[model samples]
Target: MATPPDWDRNATWGGSNGGAGGSRTPLRQAFSSLSKSSGKKTAQSLSASGSTTPAHPASRSQSPAPEQGDGKPTVASDAGLADDLDNKAKLSLSRQSSVSNKSGAGSAAGRDAGAATAPKGDGEEDTPLQRALKNPYHRPLPGHPGNLTTSQAEALLELTQLLLKDGALHDPEKEPPSYQETQLLRFLRARSFNVEAARTMYLKSEAWKKEFELDRLCEEFIFEEEEAVAACGWRMYFHKVDKLGRPIFIQDLSNLDTTKLLQTTTPERIIKKFAVTLELAVRHRYEACTLSSGRWVDDNMMVVNVEGLGLSTFWTMKDQLQQLLGVLDQNFPELSGRVQIIGAPFMFSAIWSLLKGWLPAATVEKVDIAGSGYLPLILKYVRKEDWPKHLGGECCCSGATATGSDGATPAKGKSDGCLHSDEGPWDKDLVVGASPRPS
Candidate 1:
């Protein structure tokens, strides 16, 4: 075969160690060379074992026994393999730490997040006057106050002027008038009498000028008229009497016809009247009395008597009375002519039936008058004298001591007689004696 080409020889040994016709090195020589080149004690020890070469110390310590059928080395038993895995894990942990440091995040972020979510306070700040306005119980503002705004101030002044004007025509107490009254007069110069007209008309009349100044008189009239309206309304409420002696009627003026009389009339007229009447009624309540005898006896059942009317105030309140009369004519025509205006009384009678028990018999008798119809008679007798003799004496007639025509004495020794006498003992005696004498 002309000796096979050198290529055939190379192929026989897989192109490295020759096989068949290729050149070859002994396995022991190769192992010896590998052991020498490695220079490891374990490799040298394994090389010395020869037979099949003992495991190296590093390999024996790290590698597990290979599986019977598998050709791959066990990863758990491989020393290099475990070291590679550990090195990769350490590299990954280092990278994570570096990233966290660069970002700069911590616990402070949590606190800020909580503060952004927290509720909000009532808004009740206001001035004393403002608060008063909001409160239901606060009193209404007067005609003027320094703190009021310009518009409010103007309105107040106008209202004050109106009230003063009304007072001039109706209020007697505001006699001689005031600066406010003068301003009101100027305002009403054409409609009502003014100071110049009064001077022209009354300056010549000595009597008129002495008794009254025209301007003052006119003002008095206006003031009185206003006061009367107020007084009427007030009396109706405090005395619990209506325009017709019925129960009080506190109705609104909205429904009532107040437009017919004076163009200047207003709801305030009624309100002011009601207020004044209440004050006066309370003051005069104890002094109020009804007339018992006369042409007009019982005619004015609920009418306050003249004694209780306090006439000294009449001149001051004359304008008020006229205004009241005007109001009465406008609203309650029935009482316009019949109602008798009166003044407050000087004294009041306070009677207590229980107190009678404490009084002496004679004193009770002296207080009691004859033929004067019960209470009226007693009052008259008491008015006439300082104190009755019977009140200090043993006579137990109580206040019924007025003598009868007969000589017979009043009944005694009976509780009913001591308290209330059914038939007047004096009456019986008088009747008995008046009877025809036994002929």
Candidate 2:
């Protein structure tokens, strides 16, 4: 809840470090796991972290290539390509224009099967990036102006009236309840300023809130096993505010012992705990931050440490991750500030290549993947003093995986004071003595 550090204003989605005004939607899309451009395939994706690629070629394949037709890469003869182009060009101009129309892009009636598969985003003015940010809860939505532009507000009000007429909201003052301007905007933004979509989404979320008794959950849901989970290398801890007053959530998935995790808990139980934590964070921590700092704080900054991950870990954790991220994406849209994946192993590319299609494009764009050399980038959002010592900082979180020792989790016990990041400076930036993000 402390005032956001001045460095917060420097958070930029575009390429420029600190103070950039553009959104890197184009670049992010270009690097999407589905995108096979050589530039994206290379280690260049890690360049944003300010790390240099090793001189010796360390990567095998940049990404997983698609299954080929008949075990051979399809060969397109130059002559055949030229003929196809000529035939297309010879068509009537009107015919070509009609083919170009977005509505007809996927229609096989008049276009070649290959042609019909043209990029899906061509006619849409909003990029995948823009759509993802429509309901932004982060720093003024990267480049877009004030949260929920005036026009968006009007659209949301229209939705309210529709719901009112439908009797979905019976009492203007009591029933269906009133929400903050920003909260109302969040629903509208999540649905891309579309009134009906927002209406439906808002109604469903309201129903979910009531059905789950979220109020009571927030009051009573005790994460009794949090410390136990932390000891298993599956830490989900919220330490302190970022430069922007958004809470920092650290989840270490890199060093997990899958066998131990399975024995300790089932996938469903683990997911339930995560959902409860996220709900509490969104509903409580966010409000507390906004109240204390007198600034809107709904989104959170995520630091995913994927160090020491291997195929075994991926197979074990895939379902859990898919479920967690899926809920966060569709149900809790626009709640991500800056998502950084540090210490990513080469093996991660395989999983991502397969998983990218399943994730929302906007969410995919927000992830910044880096090799072990992500410390500098992490410091951009959190001061070095507050960083975990295992990752090259002064603070030594009590439960961090043993560096020199094997990946076995340390014993369960109360952490040393430094492991709790809440103790970190709040009145001002902790520029000197380091503080641990919570254990």
Candidate 3:
């Protein structure tokens, strides 16, 4: 991959002067540029990959799912907003190119791509977790014993309401007030139950999409940096889904040439690359699920190999790392369902700890630190055949084992101090600062 040599040349976020953990936007009014469509197009166009392609219609029709447990599609709103939706993105674009797997590398994170989001019905034992996946925002109060925690429920309510107000939605079919059950909960969780913070985060996301005219960007964008990404040795590729049903992503962060990386690609390109990749993956999986089982699941897991990480390597891209985290947190919200960190060096502990502060408490917690038994930890969620032998799996990629991640020293805790339980909304310990217990 020929690295693009103009990465640092792009303008940084003039939007905020705040560094890592600073006072972000004040919700009711987050960023000043809340509406990127407000004529900065020409000014910013010179800075970004400005598309001359006209903007596509931002709103579209929605296919109502069963109003969760009520067994009916949500009733149309008196406001007629029911006709405008799927920032579930259920609405389609006319493009033919499915974001293909020509990505740089692979991991055992693959799943049935055709995975469905089916709710428990007759003969199917319904549990809180199962219900949450079906529709965590659905009613019956989510607190009727074995239901969602007070924090989780309230967080969803606050964040979803914000999205709805901002015109983002996916709601209950037949229910009257299951209200704005948008898929924005992941962002809320990522902020550790901070409604205002979550709201600001999501608003920035919306603003970004609008600025880039993302609906059309996804329909027309093509990420040709595959070779450059591969050259970085930190392969940012998509693999199959995991058995537990999340798209798998693999990146070996240690081997990349940070100097080359910075010299070759701008932050805008990196952000766009990640965004377009995600759009393709989500659309691909959504289609696969709808076609195969008439359902939808949108989330993924990852394998990050830190084999060669050292203080020097860490310092080299420290700024980039900070930028990447901010961009992803604001833009990619809740997409990475889980992460497995392998090939961790003693230096890994420091970097991990630092990075954790930048990430939402929920995201940090879901991070699983692999020990000497890395393969087993991975195999628990991903099958052996799904991964390549380099990672201690039985899978053969393109007839050869791609040497990837290796090595790990177990962190002191069974839960690894990374994330909360994946069980469901029933967890009270789900909140940050809650005591960590065995998984």
Candidate 4:
């Protein structure tokens, strides 16, 4: 893929004077203009009015899946606000583009043609996650013990009420709420079900999303250096699943060439890629996993291999990694299933001591650092047929391998095996289309 033209430009959050001061971001300005142009009060306005009236419509229609062209989700007329945002966002992106052009950067970040929203198609046999896409505030999947408790359900209702009254959930000109019940639960769980604290966190997250232009980033941002970055040994891809059926994200950072990676893609581009990837996982991968598992699968399991990370390499990549981790902690709370760190070298201890201090206590608790003979622990979560033979599991992407109990084998691929083969429940039995699904 050709490189985008806005990768090197600096991304500013809020306004110049800082914290919603000075000049507003182009999207924020667009939203302000939109609110003025439209005579009706926006959700934001309604919330501030402090009216007891409810904001949501009495009933909502489920939208259809992606139509033929461009693989983007189509919204109804009532959802025109999001469509307008997409147009304005595209126009405002040129300021960043011009900055990159002036700097003469060879590879820059550029958005895809349109800002796509989640598909809202209704299929009678759809999985819980798919149904959730169709209806933003979907109820929990039936018969799952992990389903919300009676009190938690009531709390969810209360939380949504608070968000509606505060107008903190929906930013009409930016993006709509997604899996709203599950999303609210995420914040509630993160804040230990304190409605006020969760509300605060949710509001801050929404503000940050606007400042970061998250909707546009998720819909249109393209990682032009994906192949080159992978070639440089910065590999992180969704592979198979763990015991609980969450997608397994294999991040092999042992061979990362920091200098080459920087040369290939800007740090800004890398951050955008990370955000986009998470958005995709939330929108598509998790949904597919939920379908395949016959239960709701909301998060993912990650395995990080850091054998070759020395002090020098750590210093070189620390800032980027820190930013990525911060993004995970602040924006995507309660979404990680587990993080297993394998192939830890002796020096990894010293590195962990420094790094753990910077991470949230909750996030730190989710991570498990394993030493030699860690394969057994990994296998306990990942099936033998799903993991790569090279990684000490049974499956080999090559067709000749006999791995599964049945005559099943992973779809054939290169000799490197499961690391590159994105074979999982997500791909087993689905027919979305030739084009990739919208985030």
Candidate 5:
């Protein structure tokens, strides 16, 4: 793997960011970068990119008003937060800690509902993502030092031994007979390295995958309403990479016509679309990126544009949105590098109030909201060449015409436009058994 990028050695979760270093536990440090204040126009420096260390806004003395009844969001409190420099270190995985739902923030309920409600497979055609899931494969995780501190390395050793002894690491009937370190570490980090908790979560997630036949969904299911959904201005697709080589997932609600979307597709299909995309990311995008970037690229960066989203529209889709969040929190833990929400409109605060409640506390921390002047802020993490022209970048995947001198040519198959192109390094010939691209 390529050498991990350089980050400031001194900027830890507590020191340069906020909170008392020693007194702060993993949970506290996870929330350390979150400012109590909201509705501010200024950009929050929440980038976990290895290339920069810009100043972040100070945390307010008074805790910000909770988006829900209690201030806590619904996800697990493991140190999977984006801004914490040493996120792995902040994982206070001690067995005695009060952090609940180590399997996931709201996974128990989700799992139960899934088991009861999930449709049994009828031997439909399988999808590529599903096939990939069933086949045994191992790939390096995010090739970065952030995954392992000296203590984390030791903790990893301990966790591995415990899982091994428990006979939880291998399951020939349900899963492959072996596992990868990267895979194990992903769960351990999510549960703050609590051996028993990580083991339980791992087992439960595997069961959930089997019960839901997630692999089959990924392999066979295709959104018949994909074109219609895009025509309705609900954009969700992989575009490019950030400065640190993480793939960028662009979700534009600026032109979303919620009514048309509802008329065209059902809530169940929307959720399925999202799940397929996520599984693809894990099976294809993440692996391709890891191979191309010469670094383990496990997570992706999100860019959400909510310029025209209004309170009414938000309220109309609130249920669907919460269901999506629940799916993410329950199934895919710690898979985001950062979730940058840009082009926030006047009613965004109200929207945020409703939205934060559905998000996990760890995920809420990874989110960085910007009302305006977001182009420059977003550029800090995503370079102009990789970004789309609509987002104020040089690349014009719409085939209009390339304008920048950065040599970022319009991606092929421009007829589909940028959102539909699904363009990124993963498309290059370097992913599958080829040599790593030059970093």
Candidate 6:
């Protein structure tokens, strides 16, 4: 066969051959050569002057490219390429070192830049213990409830000791009089001497002395005045009542308009009622039960049967009654029930006033003789003649005599006796006409 133009005559088949027509190399060798030549041509075309461009020094040192033949490129062994990369790296490092040494300022600038970009410290100046102490809401220590340090505890103890000393040394005599006591004394001093202009006599007296006498007399006559005043004060407030003829609401002096009620015609009447009620309560302990059983069994069942309703007891009852009135007003206004009572002076006066103004005459008349102990004393003073009629005279059988079966008159002498005379029609004056005719 004729030899191809591209074929080499002296090419080695599997070894070196003399310049003569020889057997061709292996197919793999031929293909490899061809590829190398092709790669070389491509690389030349891509380069500026039809030559291969040099790679970056670091990259070239790390990995070298394969060699190229006239017609193709050859693949380099991995080991050989690695060695070349190592040599190129050394050269680059040497260059960098030389540059850094020549300009120390450049290296310093780089370091500064790195530092600027790095994270800063948090700038916390307090230590762990200081931070804990400065915390506003720190918890107590393990053994201490208040967590007070020794210095703080000592300071508190000193303050407590000072307070104790002050308290222990405090005395009323050393201090100035209180504002209230001063005012009271001033008022008493001012009212000490009053011109009575009674008949034709003018009297000068200390106000406190007169007040003391008046207060003592009031206690003696009114009986429970002190207790009542202490418990209920001078003024009162009434809240409500039910239809059962019982006080459903009551208050005392503090709640009422003392200036208006005490000065007006109200107080005297209330006092009378209080006195009468107190007397009746004292006298009719067993009688109350009898009356309660006879005519008022059903109604009187709820009535308090204590021996006496003292000022304190009355005040408490009044308060409860007032509360009851309030409840009635809220829950049952249709009953149109009301709370009424005599506070300091007389309960009967309050009842009479209310009856005269708010109720019918018949109701007032009926109320006069209701015989509720508190009312009768006030009725005697207000409507003496009407009192007997309404109250069915003194006795249920014989209505003539002012004396009871025990010969106890109503009010002939002192407070213990009746106020009326005990002389009856049978007890006539001694007749002297027959004696004068015999002489």
Regarding TM-score, does 4 or 6 come out ahead? 4
C-alpha local distance difference test of each model: 0.24, 0.46, 0.43, 0.52, 0.51, 0.24
Structural RMSD, model 6: 56.0
The pairs that clash in candidate 5 are 2-294, 75-360, 126-219, 126-220, 127-219, 127-220, 130-219, 141-296, 142-296, 143-296
Candidate 1 off by > 4 Å: 1-235, 238-301, 305-311, 335-439
Clashes by residue pair, model 4: 7-108, 7-109
Clashing pairs in 2: 421-436
Angstrom error of the Cα, residue 405, model 2: value is 10
Tens digits of per-residue lDDT for model 3, 1-439? 1112321111111111111232232211111121121233322221122111112122113122222342111222211111121222232211101111212112111111111222223544222122222221111111211123444555555566676777654322211121112245456545655778878877777677777765565555554554565456555655544553344677657566777776677667776767766655543332222222112234566789887778777888778779878878778776665678987877778888788888866577568786446877776666677664455666544423223234222122211111212111111211111111232
Write model 4 residue lDDT over 1-439, tens digit each, in one string.
1112332212222221112444323322222222233223322222222111122231144221223232111221212322332344444345334423443422221111000111111221211222222222221221111333344445566778998888666443333223345567677766656678888888887778778887667656666666677677677676776655578888878667888888998878777777767756654566445434423467778888886777788889889888878776777786775788988888889899989987866567678898757887787667677776656677765333444434343333322545445666443212122112223
Regions of model 5 farther than 4 Å from truth: 1-146, 161-179, 398-416, 427-439
TM-score of 3: 0.54
Weakest ten-residue segment in model 3 by summed lDDT: 105-114
Q: Count the clashes in each prediction.
A: 46, 1, 24, 2, 10, 36
lDDT of 3: 0.43
TM-score of 6: 0.15
Model 3 per-residue lDDT at 404? 27
In angstroms, give how far residue 227 of model 6 lies from its true place: 16
Give each prediction's root-mean-square deviation over alpha carbons.
Answer: 57.0, 19.2, 19.5, 18.2, 19.3, 56.0
Winner on lDDT between 1 and 5 is 5
**Candidate 2 vs. truth: CA RMSD?**
19.2
Q: Using lDDT, rank the candidates from best to worst.
A: 4, 5, 2, 3, 6, 1
Error of 1 at 243 (Å): 17
